[model samples]
Target: MTDPSQPEDTDPDAEDGFYVLHLFVTGASLHSTRAIANLKQICESYIPGKYSLEVIDVYQQKALAEQEQLIALPLLIKRMPLPERRLVGDLSNTEKVLTGLGLSR
Candidate 1:
């Protein structure tokens, strides 16, 4: 769990929306590595410092996987700013991922 007391880049009380991304991967498979790299690139390029990202390895914490209801590896969960969302797979489709995060028009 993130420390809510620590100051975040964005004002928690501000009206402007922010995003919390949780990525779940399994082991060190090629797909897992690719998803991490690709998602990071997209977030840095599009969302930049506006979002917070947390990567979790289901292989290390199987309980979290079940709790999150993750059906597959390389799952990305958008946890904040209302309308919680998720994307599953290797995250190769940049456009779809962006759309899912409501970052693209």
Candidate 2:
């Protein structure tokens, strides 16, 4: 009952699909800058093109922040791949952040 011409699906969580992350930052503060750098490093080293990151500055878009129920200055929301997750602060903890985003090895 399988098509020989089609490639086999090898990913275990392929059904879950990729992830979309929304990073909420208050301003161009140190924490926000660090969060962006750290997140970029992690994603590039581990997940690569498996996810997408959308950075939103609350200082510029306070209404969007309020809509997402953001109460912290730097918050990362994993919006896709099922079982949404949130992480607050500068995102310095690589393991914790990766685990939260379901990208940990």
Candidate 3:
């Protein structure tokens, strides 16, 4: 379903549509590092050039973390393509991450 708050042109079904994703992680944590790699792999394989990923280390950017209300060690936020979504974990499950980001396998 399309989110009413989003612009009509922002179609989630469009293969060429752009996506803005923010990944927040705690500094130096193994899980955080893994999440970053997993997220990057998923984005490259799935969205390719149609997505922008921003990896933010909460330890370095504490203000951003607090502003985004990040309560998890590794958090992924889909900021674009309509209704926002979030997934928190090591991001090892590719299928789950894809689904959470509203993408198909």
Top candidate when judged by lDDT against the true structure: 3
Q: Write the per-residue lDDT of candidate 3 for residues 1-105, one digit (tens) a residue.
A: 769965454354645668899999988799999999999998898889999999999889989899998777799998887668889999999999877777643
Candidate 2's displacement at residue 3, Å, is 26
Q: Which ten residues in a row have the lowest lDDT in candidate 1?
A: 6-15
Tens-place lDDT per residue, model 2, 57-86, is 998997898899877769999888656788
Candidate topping TM-score? 3
Clashing residue pairs in all predictions, respectively, total: 0, 0, 0
* Residue 43 error, candidate 2, Å: 0.6
Between candidates 2 and 3, which one is better according to TM-score?
Answer: 3
lDDT of each: 0.81, 0.81, 0.84
TM-score, structure 2 vs. true: 0.82
Pairing residues by index, what is the TM-score of model 1? 0.81
Give the runs in model 3 whose Cα sits over 4 Å from its true position.
Answer: 1-14
How far is 49's C-alpha from truth in model 2 (Å)? Answer: 1.2
Candidate 3 C-alpha RMSD relative to the actual structure: 4.4
Clashing pairs in 1: none
Please give me the total number of clashing residue pairs in predicted model 3. 0
